[model samples]
Target: MNQPETNPDAPLPRPSTFPDGLRVQVQGFDDQQAADGLGEQLTALFVQMGRYFDIQRLDGVTIAIDYEEALRSLDRGCATRELAPSRGRTVGVAMTPSVLRDGVLKSHVFVDAAVFFGMLKEDRYERAMQLLAHECAHVEVNAHYDRCFPDTLLRTKYMNAQQGARSEVILASWDEYAACALSAKRGENPEADYRETFLNDLADARERGNECIKAYRLHSQVGQIVREIREIYGGLMKHAAYYLGNAAGFGKSWRDDPAVAEALTEHWFLPFFERLETALAALYAELGVWPNHDGFEVIGDIGEDLMCEGGMYFYDSPDHPGEVGVQLPLTPDTVPY
Candidate 1:
């Protein structure tokens, strides 16, 4: 009998067993084998990133996917980054991309049915992996901002901005824009470029007479934010949903999922970004952060609300009273951990 070929690129024996700092807590699924495979894939992805980015502390995160309630959460309205803690130690402190110290520091992600099913669909698994990568990118971003600011309110403003006092919406959206640029997983797994995939899908849509996704790079940070500010989602969101659904074969039961992505693209994204840029200019004008700008430099030593101190990263203002702010966290964390 012929022997199956072996992969030369398979990782060498590591010091630890499975699930180092990064872990998985799946709920509402009865399919153990499939879930285990999913968990293993996610764990390997994290491990690969840990070594590639040199993030020793990458193990401090847990990602949960509750297939059942995920769609329910979307039905009612929900936010991404739904499974994280609320403190400095909880947010994590992976000192660099290459080294993440493992410990009590925590961050997490919650994937729902729409994305879960999409990931399982043939030819779409790697595309969904990029979305997961976006969420993973969020872990470090959270660690950077949450630990950078000792005060909850300051971190709140940095993350949520016009978003409500509890919303960490902006950071999530920003990272989403940052994470999907690569063709596939950077360190280990090889897959198609997400941008290329989207373009090919867009071409497929165009051939089918759909044009909502616009033949531009919707995969970039500035592109997403700028488009949303222009109220692009108002018109394009539904069409995009149709395209996304058709591409994934998700059908009508998952119709709203893409709309939710579209809605979030508009609401949570714009305010924080608008305010952050304004605040950055103010900080530079005041010269608080010269060259070495850690994410926390804007927050000051003791969690001073930068907006009130002649700064503006949110709509509420003592200087400009009665101005509107971003929408609040409209939904609860579906898989609170």
Candidate 2:
């Protein structure tokens, strides 16, 4: 295994180890009491997670809770760093990109306190723990995955922004499914909620697409070189991927429900949803098996399948030379003012 690069200039946080060998590093808290309180709770929560999963693998891992620092670090790594925070959000992150601290390759679990504490303020403790468990499961799965297969997809450099964005969505879909499946054994099963969320997103995307079409027909106006329809459709695709993956992770019985089946079919995303769910289950089942496989490659293939089967195709934009345009699964009719 290649050793993680050392950054000597990085500031070190004071990490505390609990009785179970779980180490947590808390930062960006003004009140020491609050910091200690959160640390103790996190340690306890990790211990609880150990009951179902082999969390012992995370012994040397450092769980970092820093809102501001996490935001800065994640933004630095993102392509849309110049864009406002409302464009995207990061609540937690995990795994094999270990940091070298004091000559030791230490894996990490990062949770943004801004999000976690906000959930707690709303008395959403179960949801917060579910998020934490999902991150921790990412650490566990990533470690095991590294030992098995070489992740060729994410590690490779993409040629363009669109390619990079597509890869990001695929990778995120696979990661969320694996982590959510593993964590849901001990956490909450949110399949019903996820199903509703996806349907709602589909409705909103279609509405936005309608407005974009109306604007283009009347004034020959669009959001940018890329049409607003494509942007909203792309976002809708990602939302479907994430929610369907999460729903499948907990349980797939929802798929058989009359309402969900009808809604998915009507929205024209059922094919993609089915393909993704099938691929996710296959990849997850192959984990820890004898022969190693590149699960990321499988996901990439699934993405191709979805694009072909779900009516998502790309063409050169007629209005903007050298620009790629997407054809969505559902066509939006122009709406009147």
Candidate 3:
């Protein structure tokens, strides 16, 4: 008997849990009073979100206030590199196991101590709560997908090929949209935050594209290395979609904005993004009211449209023999560093 070949880009296994039933864990606060206060805040937040979202699968879930420590705890059973926190608007994250168990993700949430406490120091309690709420919404979203699409491994299949990767990106963008939409509906103003973040991500995506071109041209290790390089850019583009998702969820338009136009100059992403936004707007219109098969098809249609319009995907490189070749919307000459 032989073992199956594993997908290198597949998500690692989930973190181990203790027998203790503590749902909120706070660390690094010197004063016990401060730690206790933070614990109460987190517990209350979870309770509030759980009630509103009707989330009932939080039995094994844990909320860690210290991100580094939380990542260490989450990385314990994994052999791969440690998990990293997102460095964007909200430095918090929610994660689930690589595979669902009993149609539940049992997701956990982690909040960066520095960001959370920094906002507290500035008396930005509302913003800090908003960040936590956004992450909580992510946990709900994960659970919803896991339960609704129990047999699917879409996120885990991201690195299977270009279509899988693109699907992964679109799914991630949808997750952000759903999360932000939930938070916005709960009285947090994610729309205002997205108004600025979207342009920043556009500029970042532009720079990433330029760097990818430069690296692709200069590197001798174009086979495996180029594939890795493309994935790096793809990851950044995935984050850029987060902001784009924000716009769609909030019904905000950036097409007429001068800053967005300037950022997209000499860039080929505008049309693709417009198409994605249209797909997302459709999804947004049906949020929280998924109709079984129709809901799944609605999500699937976005990927179909994305692949159809872009004319870019990962394909086996016939020219390079064993290597993977990618076709992107932008050419090497699209932007020069």
Question: Could you give me the TM-score of model 3 versus the true structure?
Answer: 0.69
What digit string (tens of lDDT, one per residue) describes model 1 on residues 152-245? 3222233332333213222222222223222124222322232233333323321221122222233434333322322222112222222232
Query: Which ten-residue region of model 1 has the weakest summed lDDT?
Result: 89-98
Colliding residue pairs in candidate 3 = none
The C-alpha lDDT values of all candidates are: 0.34, 0.54, 0.55
List the RMSD of every prediction in angstroms: 15.2, 9.7, 11.2
lDDT ranking, best first? 3, 2, 1
Please state the error at residue 33 of candidate 2 in Å: 3.7
lDDT by residue for model 2 over 252-276, one digit each (tens)? 5555767667777645556556666
Q: Give residue 249's lDDT in candidate 3 (0 to 100).
A: 50
Model 3: weakest 10-residue lDDT segment is 12-21
Cα TM-score of candidate 1: 0.39
For candidate 3, the lDDT comes to: 0.55
Better of 1 and 3 by TM-score: 3
Top-lDDT structure, candidate number: 3
Which candidate achieves the best TM-score against the true structure? Answer: 3
TM-score order, best first, reads 3, 2, 1
Which candidate, 1 or 2, has the higher TM-score?
A: 2
Q: Give the backbone clash total of model 2.
A: 0
Please identify model 3 stretches exceeding 4 Å from their true place: 1-22, 32-34, 59-66, 75-81, 87-103, 153-159, 220-241, 244-251, 255-267, 287-313, 316-331, 334-337
